[model samples]
Target: MQLLRSIGFFHGNILLFCVTTGAGIFVSPKGVLKYSSLNIAVSLSIWAACAVLTIISALSLAELGTTFPRSGAPYYFLKRSLGSSVAFLSLWIKFFIYPLGIATQSLIISTYIIQPFYTRCPAPELPKKCLALAILWSLGLLNTRGVLTVAWFQTISVLMKITILCFISLTGIVLLGTGKKENVAKFENSFDAELPGASQIAEALLQGLFAYSGTSILINIAGEIKNPGENIPKALITVLPMVAVVYILVNISYLAVLTPQEIISADAVAVTWMDKVRLPFIFGSIAISLFLILTPMIHSPKVEYIYGFIFIFSGLLGYRLHVHLNQRSVCFDKITCYLQLLFNVSPPEDQDEGISTGKKHLEEIFL
Candidate 1:
C-alpha cells in the first residue's frame, strides 16, 4: 500500500528541522573544538562552512526528489542510474547501520540524562546501556504506531529543544552585555594559533556536519509529502537555514560562558552550560526530559569515524564490482528498466537517451 500524503509543508518542516538539529549540536562541539585546534575563529568558521555545505546538499536532494517523484530514496536512484546490485548493497549496509544509529542515539541521550546524576564521576556503562535499550524499545514502539504520531511527538519535543536553545543564546547575549566580553567574543586571535593539519581540518568539518546530517530525511520520504515539487524544496530551503542559525547562536552561547579549555574538557556541553549558568537544580531534570541523542558504539570519538569509513569504503568497493559485473542493458524500450530502477518502465516513446545521463556515468556522492 502507498503512504498517504498526510505530510504537508508544515509537517515536512518539523521532520526536517528535528532530523538535522539533533544532539550533535550539544556534544559535537567537543569534536569540532578538538579538531579545529580549539581556536574559536576556526571552529565557528567550520560550523558556518558545514552549514553552507548542508544547504547545498539539501537543495540538490530536493531537485532529485522532485525529478524522481518516488519514495524509493537512494536505492531507487542508484538502481535506475547505476544498477540493481549497487542498490541492493546500499540496502544491505543500511540494515546494520540503522540499528547502530538507533543505539548510538539512545546511548548519547542516556548519557546526558544519566550524567547529571553522577556529578562527581562519569556514569557507568551498565546503566547508560540499559537506559539506552529502554529508550530504543520506546522509539521502536513509537514508530510502529504511525508516521503522524511520530511527527506530532517530534513537534512537541523540538519545540522544547528550541526553547532551551533560545534561553541559552539569550544567556550568552546577557553575559556579553554585562562586560563578559573576553569569553563572549574571541575573534581577534582566532586564526593566529598554529594551523591544524589537513586531516584535522577535515575531521573538524565532519564533526560539524554531523549536526546537519539529516539533509536527506525529507527526500527519503518525498512520496509522503503532499506536493513533492513545491513542498519539498520549500521545507528544505526554509527549515535547514533556520536550524543552522540556531546552531550557530547556541554555539556562541557555549563559547560565551565557557573557556575554550573548559568546552574541550566537558563531556556533555549542554549539561555543562546549564551548570555554568547557575540554573536551578531542576534544569537537569528538565534537560533529561527534553533531550535525546546518539553516540558512537565504541564510545571513543575517533572510533566511530573509523567504523563509518570502513563501512563506506566497503560499500563503494562493492558498488564498483557490482556495477561492473551487471552492466545495464543497452536499450530499455518496451522493457522493465532499472522496481529494479524504481516505479518507472521506459517505453521507447521519448527522446531521453537513458536514466543515466551519459555514455559513462560517474559516481558522485555529493554530501
Candidate 2:
C-alpha cells in the first residue's frame, strides 16, 4: 500500500500528543478527587501507572509494526494471530469505540460553545446533538479530502490548547503564592494521609484510565510511517512522559488556584477555575471545548479509513517476536512460504491466488 508523503515525524507526534491528552483538563480533577481524596502521591501514582502502561503497550506495538508493516492495525493483528471471529470482533469494537468517543466529545465541545451564547439554556436540552453532528460531519469531509490536512489542523489545535494550559497554570500558581484570600484549604488537604474508600478508588482509577484512551492513534498510521518500527514507538514514548508531566503539573496548578472542593463542585473544573481568576467564562468554555473536540478529531483518519492497519502491523511483529523467543513453527513457516508465493508471485498460490487478488481490487475502490 502506498502512503501519501505528507505527514512527517513532527506532524504525527504533535497529533499523538494532543490525542493522548485530549479533554483531560475537563475531567481529571474529579477523577483525582475520587481516587485519592486529594492525596497527591496516590493521584500522581495512578496517573504515572497509566502513562507507563500506554508507553509499554506502544512499545510492544512498535515491534509488531516493524515486522509486519500492514494496514488495519488491530484488525490485522487479531485476524492473523487468533482467527477471523476474534479479528472481526476487534474491528467491530474499534468501529464503535472511535465514532462514539468522537461523538461524545463533540457534544461536550458544542455545549461549551453554546454555553456562552445561551447561559440560560437548560442543561438537559442544550441541542448539542445537532451541533455535534455538524462538527463531526465537517471533520469527516476534511479527513476524506486528505489526512495531511487533518494532521495540520490537529497541530494547530494542540498548540492553542497548550498555550491556554500554560497561561492558566502560570497565573494560578502565581496567584496562590501571593497569599491571596482564596480558599486554599482543599488543595492543601491533598497531603493528608487518609486513604479513600474502595468505591472512590475505583471511580478515580477509571477516570485516570480515560486519560490514556487515545494512545493507540499512533498505531492507526503505522503503514504510512516513514519508519514504522522506530518512528511509531519513539512518538509514543515521547508523548507519554510529556503527558504525564503536564497532567501532574496542571493538577497542581488547579490545586494552587482553587480548593479541591471547588474543582469537584463545578461541572467543569478548567472553566470554573478560569472563571474564578477573572477570566471570562466564555473564553474558558471555548478553550476547554477546543481541547476536547479538536485533539481527538486529529486521529480520526486511522479510525475511519485504515481502521485495522496498526493492529495488523502489530500482530505481524508479534508473530516474528514469538518465533525469536521460541522455536519456529513448521505451520508458521509453511504459511509464510505459501503467502509469499501467492501474494508476491505471478501464478498466485491457490488460496493466495484469490485473496491477494481480491485485496488489490478492493484497494482500488477505496484509494
Candidate 3:
C-alpha cells in the first residue's frame, strides 16, 4: 500500500520527460567538443545515436518495469536479472553520476546569472562554489516536498526552455531569409581544420550518452503507477521523440548562430551563445535559464519528500479507508438482515458476524 501511494499515477511519460531533458543541452556542448573538435555534423550524428540508444534502453526498461512493477524498481530488476553486486553498482552510479551532473548543471546555469552582474556588483561577487552550493540546497528544499508538484514543475520548465530555443531558431531563420548576413557559411570550413577521428567518434558517443542519461527516471517510480503495464509504456513511447527533437533543434540553433570555433572558444555555452543574441534573446535567455536553474532545485526536494511522505501516508490512509468501508458494510448487512427477518426469510451467514461487530462497536461508542 505504501509503495502504491509513492509510485501511484507517475506514468512513464512524466518520468521520461524529467530524466531526458534534465541537464543535457546545458552540459552536452562542452562534452561534445572535448571528444570531437565540435564538428557540427559529427556532433549531431552522435547525439542522434545517443537518443536512439536511450529509446532502446527505455524499451528494455519498460519490459522490466512491467514485469516487476514494484517499489524497489530498477534496483529490483537489475538485482534479479544481473545479480546484486551489479545492481548495487548501477544504483550507486546513478545516485552520484546523474545527480552530480545535475548539480553541476545548476551551477552552470546560475553562473550565467552571476556572470552578467559580476563587474557591476559592489564587492565583485561571491565564489562560484558558493553559488553552486546555494542552488543545490535550494533545490533540495523544493524536492523534499514530493513528486506530483515536481512533475508539474518539470513540464513547465521544459516548455519554457523549449520555447526560448524555438524563438532563437526562428530568429536565425528570419535573419537568413532577409539576407541579413546571417553567416551560415562561416562554418563551411569548420570541418576543414580538423574533423574528428575514429577514436573521437567513440568518445563523442559516450558524451552523448551522458547528455541523454536520465531516460529511465519513470521506471524508478513504477511501483506508484496506477496501471504499471499500460501507463509506463505509453508515456515512454510518446515522450522520447519530443525530447530528441528538442535536443537536436536546440543544439543546431547553437551551431547555426555561432560557428564551431565560436562555440568551442567559450567556456560556457549559455554565456557565449546568449551574448550573441539580440537583447530580446539575451534577456529572454537569461530569464528562461534562471527559471530552468530553479526548476531542478524546486522539483528535487519535492520529489524526495513526496515519495518519503507517501511511505508514511499510504498505510494510514489505507487503514482509515478500510475501517470506514468495513463499518459501512456492516450497516448494509444489518439492514438486509432486518428485511429478511420481517419477510420470514433466512439471512446470509456473514451478516451475523458483521452485524454483531457493528453492534458491539456502536454500543461501546454510545456508552
TM per prediction: 0.74, 0.69, 0.67
Candidate 2 lDDT (Cα, 0 to 1): 0.71
Candidate 2 residues lying further than 4 Å off, grouped into runs, are 38-41, 117-124, 179-189, 279-367
Tens digits of per-residue lDDT, candidate 2, 1-367, equal 5875455678779878878767655676666765677676677677777667767876777666666665567677777899999988887897898888888677767766565544333344446788888998998898897777888889888998788777776776676677755535544545566777778777777778776678777676677667676777778777778877777667767777766567777666766666567654577799999888667667664454355567787888877777667756656655655575568754445877778765665454445
- The per-residue C-alpha lDDT of model 3 at residue 13 equals 57
* Model with the higher TM-score, candidate 1 or 2: 1
Model 2 deviation from native, Cα RMSD in Å: 30.0
lDDT of 3 by residue, 1-367 (tens): 3654444444345556666765557667767866786666668777888889888998898888789887668899778889999999988887888667877777666666566654333222356668778878877887787766666766677677667657766665654555544556644555565588888888888877876777677667776677888887888778887778777767766776677676766555656666676577577799999897678767675677568668989978866775656535555556655565569676447988867865665565445
Candidate 2, residue 152: the lDDT equals: 86
Comparing 2 with 3 on TM-score, the higher-scoring candidate is 2
Clashing pairs in 1: 104-294, 104-295, 105-293, 105-294, 338-341
For model 1, residues 1-367, the per-residue Cα lDDT tens digits are: 9888788888889988887777788788988989988888888889999999999988987888898777866778899888999999989998998677667767888989999998767889999999999998898899898888889998998898888878888887777777755764564667787678899999999999977877798888877888899999999889888888888888888988888788889878888888887764477667765553223334545666777779999988866765777744444422333333466444444437553542233222111
- Report the error of model 2 at residue 127, Å: 3.1
Number of colliding residue pairs in model 1:
5
Clashing residue pairs in all predictions, respectively, total 5, 13, 17
Candidate ordering by TM-score (highest first)? 1, 2, 3
Please give the distance, in angstroms, between residue 175's alpha carbon in candidate 1 and its true position after superposition. Answer: 1.2
Which ranges of candidate 1 are over 4 A from the true structure? 279-367
